[model samples]
Target: MRSYAGQPRPRPLPARYSRQELPKDHLVEAVLVTIFCCMLTGAMALIYSHETRAAIRRGDIDRAFSASRKAYFLILFSLLFGMFVSITWVICVLATLYAQRGP
Candidate 1:
């Protein structure tokens, strides 16, 4: 392509396979964040499971059922939180890439 001054200009790289790759550190950070969230969720589940079982063994059916319901809600919340973090991270990476290209 011709430049404004009549000189040949280099073509811009394609977005899908551009020379500018996402930084490795950013990818690692995202992965680490995801893993951390998962671990937290798992720990919470374990705690809830143990509490529910204990309540059940004590003949407190109401307490055990309540614990079970709480556990389900906690799991749902965890899933949503994790998804939000992951999507935000992806958006951040994409924004960084676009910014690097100078608008």
Candidate 2:
């Protein structure tokens, strides 16, 4: 319909038109895995996770993906290294015990 001056009014916007969609940057997983496994690699993963979120906010999809991948790899590496250290420690302890057995 037209106004009193005979000018047609603009169409109304949809109720949900102003919503923004943000990316999920696996920050929690990074921190948790790092805290329980390897602090050094875990810190690296946390940094990358934060970078992923920032890249998403900046509308850089490629950068966000790269950062996410880095975080994932860091977490994986931390877990692997943690396992390696644990296994080595167990082996050393066993060897020490055997040596002390008077064999």
Candidate 3:
């Protein structure tokens, strides 16, 4: 075994224990997925609000009521999507941090 200065040199990994590397596109994939989810949520909310307003203006009580329900549901879905994205981001950040620290 060779030594580096006063310390022993680090040993190379054995063939049987070689690590499996992730693809370079993994980060891009993660970011795109997050953005897509957010955009979908925003689109749903916007459509719901616009339709609800139109229904109200047209004096269609039944349509307005249904639109109101849809608006609330869209808002709820957006909130849930936001929470999911945040949680996923946090987990990814933590995983990266831990991975960088090595075993």
- List where candidate 3 sits over 4 angstroms from the true fold: 1-37
lDDT of 1 by residue, 1-103 (tens): 8557773444343455333331111223233433655657645655665666565455455565676666665566666788888899999999999999994
| C-alpha root-mean-square deviation, each candidate | 28.9, 11.6, 29.5
Ranking by lDDT: 2, 1, 3
| TM-score, per-candidate, Cα-based | 0.57, 0.71, 0.57
Model 2 spans with C-alpha error above 4 angstroms: 1-24
For model 2, how does the per-residue alpha-carbon lDDT over 1-103 read when each residue is reduced to its tens digit?
8558773443333343332433457799888878888999999999999998777656566677789889989988988998999999999999999999985
Worst 10 residues of 3 by lDDT: 21-30
Model 2, total clashes: 0
Each prediction's total of clashing residue pairs, residues at least 3 apart in sequence or on different chains, is 0, 0, 0
Clashing pairs in 1: none
For residues 11-97, write the lDDT of model 3, one tens digit per residue: 443344323421111223233433555667456555655665565445444564575566566556666777897899999999999
Higher-scoring candidate on lDDT, 1 or 2:
2
